[model samples]
Target: MHVNARFWDRLAPRYARMQVRDPDAYERKLAMTRAFLGPEAQVFEFGCGTGTTALKHAPHAGHVTAIDCAPAMIGIARQKAAEAGIGNVEFRVGDLADMPDSPGAYDMVMAHNVLHLLPDRSGALARVRRMLKPGGVFVSSTACAAGAPRLFRWVAKAGHALGLLPLFNLLTADGLRAEIAAAGFEIVEDWRPEGGRAPVLFLIARKPA
Candidate 1:
């Protein structure tokens, strides 16, 4: 389910504000990401909207390649990186489904709030896995189907009924785990933050060493 750029470009302001509103969640994911990455790790961050998480962790990784589909968000992300004087990061405008031809090129790949949005998640995970170096890690977070907000789910259902949002299966953690395993990734660590109206689950999986 590739979302149109308008959906994101229109929400860029609110999207950017998420960094401030949910600093703890972002920081937790960032800390987990750092723990998984080696000093010389080459990282690729998919859907790095406005560079919120990218800018936060780019300095810690050896090199950061961040990609996004929305041009407005990309512009913001590039500017954010520049203002931070970060020199080791590259930004691109593209979808995760059409990733570049660079197999086993990265030591880590990140996809915060990106997985469930894909209709072909298994295929995409396979691609991401291929992009990893031996023992490389894929650090990510998603709204676990079980943990998704009831109100939001009802809203989504209504939207789907009203032709607003597309309808797809609500994915649970088990579903995600199976997908990752099918993509040949092994789960290394997982977390579901406890203090939230709705919990956001994060996972760190690694390509076999």
Candidate 2:
């Protein structure tokens, strides 16, 4: 995901205007995530595009710190937060690597639809692990490019090659689980919702107590 910010900056406006393709599936993910949150929770989210999920989760947590690499994305996110009068979530223009090296800082860390897009997936997961308090949870929903149809995979790669898409890793759901485990997080919930155009791997993992 570390590339020129212009790519995402160009997409920010249209991304904000787009509607959720599956409201039911989206609500299910939201509910599942909310179950892990509490009023005393301190939450951190990386690769937060437009701050939608962060804003939604704010009511359940004490504070939400969300970051994205693209300035345009953060700009739009800040606007959304102000318009919605949501004051608990702080949206910033930064990458995961820019996050402070503060171990055990957050009660929960989330990365939704972001893992497969990272060029350094293992490094990012390790960072997430370090940022969470012991026994705290990491929740993620990743697009499993390895599980996509052959034609889609080919097209995605071609698009990346032509600079039409961002960096993407063809990581399988099993491989993602293995990586999270290797990062010293215990997988507690592994789920895949049905009837999606592509496979999404939803997981809740906890740092060792």
Candidate 3:
């Protein structure tokens, strides 16, 4: 996680400048997530990169605690939030696992493009489940590299070996869904957007009520 944090810190500026590869798909994700949010919803978002999604959701949610492991990312997020005049979000730099336990504290928890980078995906999901209230939704978008093209997978592996990329777990869509279920979530929506080299799985799962 430390290495990944440093990598993200270095990439933060460039990453913020890069546009979403699929704007339509990204918009769809935001809309779908917003549908589950009410005016009074309290949200927690982990690995909240530059906090674009958090800022977008802040209008609908009552409060959003956006956390990232990289200090640079959180700094950029704070700047963006301020520029957007979004006061509902509080951006912090820390690992999700280190967050003080407050059982059933949030109405919704989101992790976008983050799960595959973790060493303990199952344990992370379990912690997320514990943070949510009963019936609370967990929204996530994960890149299932195991389903990606062979060449791309090979390149990714080479990059990791060369220290150009962080550790990534090769996960399949079905495998991720099973893990979510095993973590005590009832699957609500599972979607794989069309036309990406790698499969990006977007899911909305609810804690059993």
Candidate 4:
């Protein structure tokens, strides 16, 4: 985890720039996520790189606590939030498991594009489940690397071996949904936006009320 944090800290600037690569697709994600949000919602987003998505979510949510393990990423997120005059978001450098707050504190928990990279996907999902209010949503977008072409999977493996990529769990879309369900969420939206070479699963799952 420390190594992954350092890697992300180093990549913060470039990653922030890369956030704009697909404006339409990014907006679509925001739209889909927003659909589950309410004006009084309290949101927590893990692996919130550079805070772009958090800032985007702030208008619809009452408060947002966005966290990243990388200090550099949090620093950038704070700077961006300041520049945007966004007051609803509190950017912090920490992981979900280490957050000092109590469980069932948030109306929504988001883990976009970060689930597949975690070493313990089911454990993380379970933690997120415990963090939400009953009926609250877990909104996530994950790259289904298990559905990727063999060549792409091989390249990802090579990158991991070289320590250039974080751990990949290679979960398929169905597998991811099953994991979420097993974690006690009721799957709501399971979608894949068009265009990416690899399948990218966008899901909205709710903790039973």
Candidate 5:
């Protein structure tokens, strides 16, 4: 995770400037996520790049704690929050592993466009499960690239080897769902947006009450 921090730190500025690739899809995700939020909801978001989603959800949730390993990203996120006058979201520079355990601390936990980057997906899922209250929701949208063409996978691997990309787990959509279930989550919503170049799975799972 430390090694990946440097990669994200360097990319933070450019990443913040780049527009969302698919605005409609992004909006749909926000809408889906908002449906689970209430005025009293306490939320935790991991890999919260630039805190855009956190800020958006802050008004709907009572509070949001969002974290990323990259200091630069968190710095930008804090700046955005300040600019937006959004006080409910707390942006921090640390991954889940660095955070102190607070069992059942959050009503909802989100990991958007991030799960596939982790070296230990299952381990991270376990931690998320432990952090959420019973009946809490776990939301994630992950790119499942194992179905990509062999040549594309080879190029991606080569890019990572050359330090052009962060560590990416070649996960399949079904495989991700299975892992979530194995971690004691009962999936309630599973949807894929239409007409995407790559397969991205958007899921909402609940920790059994």
Candidate 6:
């Protein structure tokens, strides 16, 4: 998938409800994140689509600067934050290539599932690296085919062929670790989902102090 504005606009409804269907999964990730973040720290969530994760994690952090490339996504996110009455978050529409951000402005930066969309994830990681406070964490997750069913694997490749799965970098654990290391981040935590059924690799890495 191209992952442009249209792709997200089409995915908005389903994306908004993903948390409800898998709250446990999301909650687990949040718990992992809280392990690294200070109680009053600032969080910068790049590609914070629909604000679901932002709303869930905002109360824990002192503040959240949520951003997404799609204006439509940010529009809905702002509304969600407002309806939740969360006053600590600020939403912006911008791409990872050029963030409307000052360098080293956040204690932590989150990329979520955005890495797979990047054609050059290491370069993107470098961009994010320069934007964090020294020793800040870069928490992210990406799709992987390491545990996919053979049929699903075939389907994913087919989806790519059909352009429904444009450019996803299915980074296995070691692959991702190397990518982060190459970008000058140390692996703080890393895990592959159990059972080899879910094709996702979740991780946390940080710039050296």
Off by over 4 Å in 2: 1-4
Clashing pairs in 1: 1-119
TM-score for candidate 5: 0.96
Per-residue lDDT tens digits for candidate 5, residues 1-209, read: 56689889999999999988788988998998999899999999999999998998999999999999999999999999999999999999988987999899999999999999988888899999999999999999999999899988998788788887788889998999999999999999999988988899999999998
Clash totals, every prediction: 1, 0, 0, 0, 0, 2
Q: In model 4, where do residues sit more than 4 Å from their true spots?
A: none
Against the true structure, candidate 5 has what lDDT? 0.93
lDDT of each: 0.80, 0.90, 0.93, 0.88, 0.93, 0.79
Q: Where's the lowest-lDDT run of ten residues in candidate 2?
A: 1-10
For model 6 the local lDDT of residue 153 reads 65
Which consecutive 10 residues in model 5 have the weakest lDDT in total?
1-10
Error of 5 at 154 (Å): 1.3
The TM-score values for the models, in the order shown, are: 0.89, 0.95, 0.96, 0.94, 0.96, 0.87
lDDT by residue (1-209, candidate 6, tens digit) is: 23466678787777876645345666788899888776678888878889888887888889999888777789889999899999999999877777655788878889887887677887788888888889999999777655556787687667767766545555576777788898999888887566433566788988888
The worst-scoring run of ten residues by lDDT in candidate 4 lies at 17-26
Candidate 3 wrong stretches, greater than 4 Å: none
Winner by TM-score between candidate 2 and candidate 1: 2
**Model 6: which ten-residue window has the lowest total lDDT?**
191-200
**Residue 112, candidate 5: C-alpha displacement in angstroms:** 0.7
lDDT of 6 at 90: 94
RMSD of 2: 1.5
Q: Where does model 6 exceed 4 Å of error?
A: 1-3, 19-22, 146-165
